[model samples]
Target: MSDLSRTPLYDLHVELGAKMVPFAGYEMPVQYKLGVMKEHLHTRDKAGLFDVSHMGQVIVTGTDYAAAAAALETLIPVNIAGLGENRQRYGLFTTPEGGISDDLMLTNRGDHVFLVVNAACKEADIAHLKTLEPAVTVTPITDRALIALQGPASEEVLAALDPKAADMAFMDVATLTLDGAECWVSRSGYTGEDGYEISVPEAAAEALARKLLAHDAVEPIGLGARDSLRLEAGLCLYGHDIDTETTPAEAALSWAIQTVRRIGGAREGGFPGDETILAQLETGAGKTRVGLRPEGRAPMREGVPLFAAEEGGDPIGQITSGGFGPSVEGPVAMGYLPTELTAEGTTVFGELRGRRVPVTVTALPFVPARFKRKPAKVQQA
Candidate 1:
């Protein structure tokens, strides 16, 4: 194991026979003895507990939290002023040219703001936030550990510990005491299911993780299954599905940009990419993200060439994230292409193994989302 960047659960993961790999400068578990396929299926059927400590946990504090939040929103696209205490919102940071800096989660702590950003872009995110709000105290909670309890059974697991935790609705965060350690629990997940992401102190995180695992419905899940689960949920992965070169519109992420915060009306805080993104909002983006299903069992990989699927079809797009979707029972991929080629029934080409593979463009998530909504609305792919 490398000593460079290790999670609080590093020792536990090693003891479980996980195949460790380097991801975003941190030594993490990609898979375990159960393998990716089993882990993926297990998460779907039961609950998967993941140690996501590598993700950056940042806290911004000031007497005037609202003003400071508005300032931070200047660097990202979101309705920060709309956030109530202990509420969380999934958002993104954008560049001046409208490209995405990274996807993140912003939470209101009543007096402080807590942010969870991608590990790969955490350093840059900190730098950018400092550039925007120099007077606001910004501190990276590097000594914290995060764990995601994902699946339909998460309610039961949490209810066993604290019934109050089960009452928190999606996108809401609440402070809870776990074995004398304070933890920030949020009713949010990446697996298109009802779950919670817990941020606990590094010292007590391992103990809490073990306690969560002791539950019958919860099992240790490696990063391999986490990737597949998020893919099925139609979530974006930094450095792959999204990058500094990719804009929010092209990434099918305009929803992250609050409409009220656009330039036309008297918007709140003016972020870096406000003008460019507002333009894209008014006028459609030329290129957009699309999902693809290959004709056969061959899985698509990132950086694979894309074509128009004609006799002399030229390269038109590239796959960002792709693989065998366990739930779909077929090969599926997501990438960006010309807006004209993003139609659901449109056919495209994914060049694989020196041959062009027939592909059909489909809507995102590729699989129906099982997220719990008040009206039980299921967003079909």
Candidate 2:
């Protein structure tokens, strides 16, 4: 099939009648025969299995903990030393000029740090990481398959298969066995829903996937619904909404930067583009990420021009990611605009087709997040 990369569950997906498409050099399913709308609905209602094996799974470890932490701090705003073992942190990769290279998840896997980076940017991330911290052993877990089981029923569905699913806390990771195979299960997801992402050995991925699919609440979803779900959840896609030109301040991700990594403190700054980030954190960034709600039925897409409200003013910001949000039950978009225009109810204009559609600057994650952060009974593996 074009010699592109394939996940361990590719065979199962093909048998399930999925429509395969190329994504980040991997032969991924865009949708099943039932289509994107159905899959999206299924994920919101029940549970959906997404093969995210293309994503980069890596381990960054070193005997020198403090040194390694500082080296990693130089590349991201997160205070690596602060995250406890088995705890995960969200962060961004900035350019030398204070722009985001990509956003990623970092889990302190006890002595070793686990990094799940974007698929397309994996090679570059690894190369850059090596240049930054060559002493740290960064090994890509190519023999693993990443799958996301998401939706309202995700926890119940997974717990039925593995009782351990109900015992892990949010943002925490635990090593467990699934269908007699060693797996790493985390209480995390991208759809703003209660779910888990399972990392399993490639050889057993297909077998586990089959078991999950057999569950009444579980359905095999594709990349198409995954995009819509994340978009509706107001999550940024690396190359699309976030890039070397975007910054944490503008992306509304400043919380990801720890206090130690801030402007002051003995830590100073080690990450790329600290000067710009510090300036923005102090003086405030002119632009910030905001949501938009179109007044009409027409949908405003990415790259559309943005105009300030009141008396038909000048251009301000543009749409980053926009589309009909199935969860929100209407058209919604995430974009950046002047801080003054970021206020809720701030009217804006978007050039839709040949007409300027009136839009209002709204809050993001238009749909409420259903993340299951409920405290679970602590259990040691």
Candidate 3:
């Protein structure tokens, strides 16, 4: 812990009585005084503030926006060139074999592209982005802190500070001033709720966090609760649910790939492993990621081997992410199963403590998402 890097809000977390732990090479709070369960429920009902500065933030620029977008499209399997201004899209970096290198969020910020990538893979991701160097300039933003305010009450909480926040739709990015500091905000989050992810200057990060916490609906949430919330939402954790060996098609993330990058589309086959991925799109993969519900009270944690029958058979697949979903009030998990066994309601068995336990395949997102996809309607005067 002594050598681990700390975020700008590390001291604030200590003051709030957080249990600090090492995560992604950083000493971060895993839970506060309220604990994981309470913190998890609080975020679903109200708002929770998360210090996510450990993630990488980078800006890619070129002669113009199109040049930068085109350079980026060569690596990611997304239609970056068609991304609208102030809008964001989820994308992935694919390997030559069609496996996912990393998943990220990219925003088309007028003059340049803003990217937020996984914390643990930032170094490699940055190095990978440098390949687009001659065509685009890669600038790593190290002087900023990233924070997320997430929950059903997030909109009202942020709107109280700046009314303009209420007008932004889901996935919309904007530059807003809060507490007299310039902040880049995006109307999105990982908790399956309406929220905002803000990137603010290092000097102003603590002040902004404190201000947001002062609100009655906002609480200081830690990594433990963050994990549970995202698991319940059926979202993938970079290293767990997705990794270098997993292809986007097998991970059930084909939705993130726009048609333009697929076969028979105008701008197809430009990214790495385009042939492999495009073929997967036309012909499904052998195994696919699916939501799992372990029967009864016990949780089927990660790495648990999956079996097709209760006795005398080799493992079929393995659980990638699992936990007690606070919002769902039961144990939930996600893993890769054979495409033949991926149908909804199909039954499978998890080898829990050497005994096969009944588990059922189900649709993802144990809890429904509550994103504010559209702006609130206004009444005529």
Candidate 4:
């Protein structure tokens, strides 16, 4: 752990009695005194603050917004040019063979594009973005810390500091001042709840976190709870559920590719592996990612082999991400399965401890999302 880097809030996390562990080359808190289960449920019911500064933040600039968007479109399969100002979109970097190199979020921040990539893949992703250089200037932002305030109570918690936060809709990005610190905030999060991901200057990060935590509704959540919350929401963890070998189509992420980038659209097929991905869009892939629920109390963890029959058959697929979903109150998992076996309610068997356990294919998001898509109506005085 000595070689691992630490986030700006590392000391605060220690003071809060967090169990620190190594994650993505950083020493991060996995759980606080409340533990994983309580922390997870608290986030779902109230608000939880997460220190996510380990992720990469980069700004892409060009002669103008159009030039930058065009340069970015060449790298990712998303409708960047059509992205509205102060709005963000989820995108993926695809390999020449149509496999996903990484998944990322890009915001159209007026003059330049702001990107947040996975922590473990940031180095590689940054190097990849440099190819768009000359056309677009790639500037990696390092003097900032990222934090996420997530859950049903997140809006009210943040609105207490700045009333303007109440007006922002989901996927909307804005520059707000919290505790006199200039913060870039996005009305989005991984927990499938109404929340905000804020990027603030390193010097002000700790103060902002402390201020947010002072709220009765906000608690310090760690990585352990973060993983479980995302799992219940059926969100993909970069390295586990998606990676270089998995194509967006196979990962059930086709929704991220807007229709404008599809075949026959005005700007169709410009990104890497466009041909392969476009063809998959027309014709489905061999395997598709699906939600799984183990029949018994036990969890069918990641790398567990899946089979078509109860016994005596070779593995059909493997679980990619699995855990006890606190919100769902059951063991939930996600994995790839043959397209034929991907129908809802289809039965599959997972090899667990040398015994085959029954599992069912189900719709994703064990817990329904609670995002605030529209602004709240103001009450008359």
Candidate 3, residues 275-343, lDDT tens digits: the string is: 888999899999999999999889999999999998988999999999899888899999999999999
Which pairs clash inside model 3?
none
- lDDT winner between 2 and 3, please give it: 3
Candidate 4 weakest lDDT stretch, 10 residues: 367-376
Name the candidate, 2 or 3, with the larger TM-score value: 3
Quote each prediction's TM-score: 0.95, 0.94, 0.98, 0.98
Q: What are the root-mean-square deviations of the candidates from the true structure over C-alphas?
A: 3.2, 3.3, 2.5, 2.9
**In order, what lDDT does every prediction score?**
0.85, 0.85, 0.94, 0.94
Residues 1-381, model 1: lDDT tens digits: 455699999999988888999988899999988899988887888888998999999998766788778777778778887888888999888888888888999999888889999999999899888875666888899778999998888888877877877778888898888767888999898888788999999999888988988998888888888988888878899999998898888899888777668765556338777777788877989999888888899899889888986457678999999889888888888888999989998998888888888899987877666655445678899
Candidate 4's C-alpha runs over 4 A off are 375-381
Query: By TM-score, is 2 or 4 better?
Result: 4
lDDT of 2 by residue, 1-381 (tens): 678988888888899999999899899999997789889989999999999999999888788566667678878878788887777788888899999987889887777788899999999998878876666877888999999999988878777867888887678788878888899888898988888889999999999999989998889999989988998888888877888888888888888787788877567667789999888887889899888998866667788889865346667889988887777677888888889778898888887876688888887778778876756689999
Give the poorly placed runs of model 3, Cα more than 4 Å off. 375-381
**Candidate 3 at residue 273, lDDT?**
90
Q: What is the lDDT of residue 298 in candidate 3?
A: 92
